[model samples]
Target: MELRHLRHFVAVAEEGHITRAAERLGMQQPPLSQRIKAIEDELNVQLFRRKPRGVELTEAGRVFLDRARATLAHYDGAFEATRSAARGEQGRLCIGVLPTTLFHPFVPLIIRAFRTTYPQVSVTLDECMRAEAIDGLRNQQLDIAFLRSAIDEEVDLNAYPLLNEPMVAALPSDHALARSGRDAQSLSLKDLADEQFILYARKLGPSFYEATMAACIRAGFTPRLGQEAPRITSALSLVAVGLGVSLVPACMQNMTMNGVVYRRLKGAVQPKAVLMIGLRRGDTSPVVRNYVSLVRKTAKTFRPSEKEAR
Candidate 1:
């Protein structure tokens, strides 16, 4: 029988009178009685017994009533869950983030604000390299990504540029530069020209790699590469161990490496590293849309000092 039949049966059973049940259901008494009768007929069992002033439920009726109520509750709950998800109030958001992006203030700010607004939405973070994050987004393993560059090739994706800041140098704690009596803030790229560099792989994040090389070239020397890592954080780790100095996104200075110190590059023209959010083109997920909007808004309020980005 249809759900309407169960509802009619429940109303009549609860009221103990067809007339009262019809009033509660906003239907006529005769129609209510007919619906109740149809339910019993479908089940081939007597569900109600007529009385002088009202009706009484048969043993079969009591058992069926429990089932009907539970079914209704389940349907109601399912409907609410679907609606909430569509409204972006409930769902799981898988985010693929580059390690470098995590050090940026705006990224965490956006995530925290989004969580506050959508408390019911669960967020999962996947820390990955630029190429891995992009692959995750394209493969549907991730709903959105925070990365270093936009997709230059034709793809069904959209990249929203979030932050563009100047690169900074990461030096070992005992390195000559750190021990120099000169002001660390006034350190120049040209000064590090002769030092070995710990660099990020070209394919992993080409944008930052190119920027580092460009800045070194502008300083009149190609860097001596000593080691390369797939992620910026890893490069910094190498710098901390004194393998080589590294030029990283200024925001990456947020990472606390015990043996490393961050210094601004002194130059009139410095190369910049960029952070971008990538998602599928024409994505209709409400959760993803809300996150993207929140990121844009958060970026607006983020005012990093020129010194912070040096």
Candidate 2:
């Protein structure tokens, strides 16, 4: 039988009179009675006993009524769940981000705001290098990504420019520059001509490393490349060990490493670029859209405090 048959049966059973049931269902008594009879015939069982006063349910009718009500409830719940998922109120969102972004002052704010707003949506975050994040996004393994560069290769992905962070130099505490009584206020590439430098992996993304090298070249010297680190933290840690000085995003200052000192680079344009994020184009999912909006709002209000200037 169809859902209409079950509905008619339930209405007649509840009212104990076909006339009353049809009135409640906005139908006529004869059609409602025929629908119920069709349901019983399809099941090959007598579902009711008729008397001059009214109708009474049989044992089979009682059991069928319970099953019909439960089935209808299940369908109702399924419809609601589907609608919620479509509205982005309920679903899973996997986000990929650069490991360095975890230390950025505004990243946590954006995550917390999104979580608070979409309490029903579940979010998973993965910390990866820029290249890995882009790969994950393209492969559909990640819903969105936050990184230094935009995703230009994939036409299906859209990038949102968040904020720009200037690059700074990280020097070891025992280095000669650190020994000088001069505070680590500002430095020039010329000042680092004779110093060993740590570099990020060229395969990861060349923009930051290339920018640093270009600045040094503009100063009429080639940097003495000492070592290369795959990730920003590893590079900073290498600098902490007195291996070499490295150019890093300004957000690295928030990471408290004992033996590393951060200094602003002057006289040359340091590597500076807006942090752009990629999301599936036209995603329009409430969770994704809300997250993008929160990121934009956070970027506007975020001003690093003095405590974050370390």
lDDT of 1 by residue, 152-256 (tens): 683788898877887888899998888768785658788898899888988887887788888888788998988779777788889988899988888877777
Q: Model 1, stretches more than 4 Å misplaced?
A: 44-46, 49-58, 88-92, 112-122, 184-194, 217-226, 265-267, 303-310
TM-score for each predicted model, relative to the true structure: 0.81, 0.74
Worst 10 residues of 1 by lDDT: 301-310
lDDT of each: 0.85, 0.81
Highest lDDT among the candidates is held by which one?
A: 1
Candidate 1, residue 91: lDDT: 91
Candidate 1 local lDDT, residue 42? 85
Instruction: Locate the minimum summed-lDDT window of 10 residues in model 2.
Output: 301-310
lDDT of 1: 0.85
Alpha carbon lDDT of residue 204, candidate 2? 85
Candidate 1 deviation (Cα RMSD): 3.4
